[model samples]
Target: MKKEIVDPNYKGEVIKHDVAKYVPETEYVVKVLERHVEKAKHNLKGAPIVVAGGYGMGSKENFDLLFELAKELHAEVGASRAAVDAGFVDHDRQIGQTGVTVRPKVYIAFGISGQIQHLAGMQDSGIIISVNSDPEAPINAIADYVINGTVEEVLPKMIKYYKANNK
Candidate 1:
């Protein structure tokens, strides 16, 4: 038996061979099936800035401070699973391995311990700012800037500074 290769774009030459002696034609039928698709609701996929709160926020009332800062910055609000489980925010706002991923220009984490699961989602952000009382928190390791203070103490000062400077 012998084999020959042909160029698909060679219009100047023609070659013929008998392939019926070694091969046979086969036909295939494809079946189309229908399935149901559910659309996901709106999320913070493209927000330029995001503020995420964690359990260290202390309570729902303390979490409200983050919202005030987010409002001032014109940023979207997010939360860790711990905050969502604690009913501080809705599940849609959760950010982690089990939540929506985000790549914002700036990610400000308040009271978050920076678990691996949470880091997986936002580690690619252009800048990461962490605020926590513990200096040894895991989130501090990846933070571009770390503020060692409680959210209530630090966030108010940050908001005041932003307001003072932006004006």
Candidate 2:
């Protein structure tokens, strides 16, 4: 790369690269290979209930509780990007700006701090329930019901209640 002064204010101290241009070596034809798409295990878009988890859920093992709760609640599972990044769940289950959007009858957020990106995904739910230890969590502002407790403490009880009370 060759360097040159770009601004009049800057002297020899300022150096810029001489842009390089290149031509494509070859043009290749792209082919559609079977046109197969990998769909999420559950159709979150149509689910009446959605149970979403976030970074605050702690570990991947903790995420399992969400699944148990979903089963009892007859809901689909979803994750925040934070949860996906932490390897707590699969990317396909992510629900946020960078993931899929859902407007279910009931949206349950567990341990989610309510990032704007995450909120953009599920803010339109018919009912929003947030379970977080912090009362001032942003998710709480939008939640129809705010349960002030950690996921580990709250999830099992919810699961048990649903299992016992479910007809």
Candidate 3:
């Protein structure tokens, strides 16, 4: 009988999917969660939102809208691996297969091309909104709502509208 391989690159580093491993310190995990909560509070007050993207926005300044929106919502900002690798965002803010996994109230994907690796980290967000110039961008398929437009045009309008209404 031939045994089917789960992954050709398993490489002995991954824990088995069906196996339960001891984490050794539940307190440590709790402390880390608490620290994340505190830092998010310190940075965002009551906001618990995260924005994710790639460098598809075309320019660094254009990409600033993600952070701007995050600030407006008093939320955290995150990016896909490509965004960080391309220097559009910092490594600490990278989310995806090799980065932090986030469970935020809202996950906004702005100009993100939305590779599957990027989606894996944020697919469970309570709400997901994607904005992209390309209507056919892969991320749109997974988004709860898709805004088809340039981030530059869409973000400013959104900011203005929210600011006017909320104030």
Give TM per candidate.
0.73, 0.79, 0.69
- State residue 136's C-alpha deviation in candidate 1, in Å: 0.6
Q: How accurate locally is residue 71 in candidate 2, as Cα lDDT from 0 to 100?
A: 89
**lDDT accuracy of residue 77 in candidate 1:** 88
Which regions of candidate 1 are displaced past 4 Å? 1-43
Candidate of highest TM-score? 2
Candidates' lDDT values, in order? Answer: 0.88, 0.91, 0.76
* Regions more than 4 Å wrong, model 3: 1-47
* Candidate numbers, best lDDT first, in rank order: 2, 1, 3
What are the per-residue Cα lDDT tens digits for candidate 3 across 1-167?
Answer: 49986886676765566333545455466443343333332332123787666777666676687677666777787777777878776777777788777778888888898888888778878889998999999988988999999887888887788677767
Worst 10 residues of 3 by lDDT: 37-46
Judged by whole-model lDDT over C-alpha atoms, candidate 2 comes out at 0.91
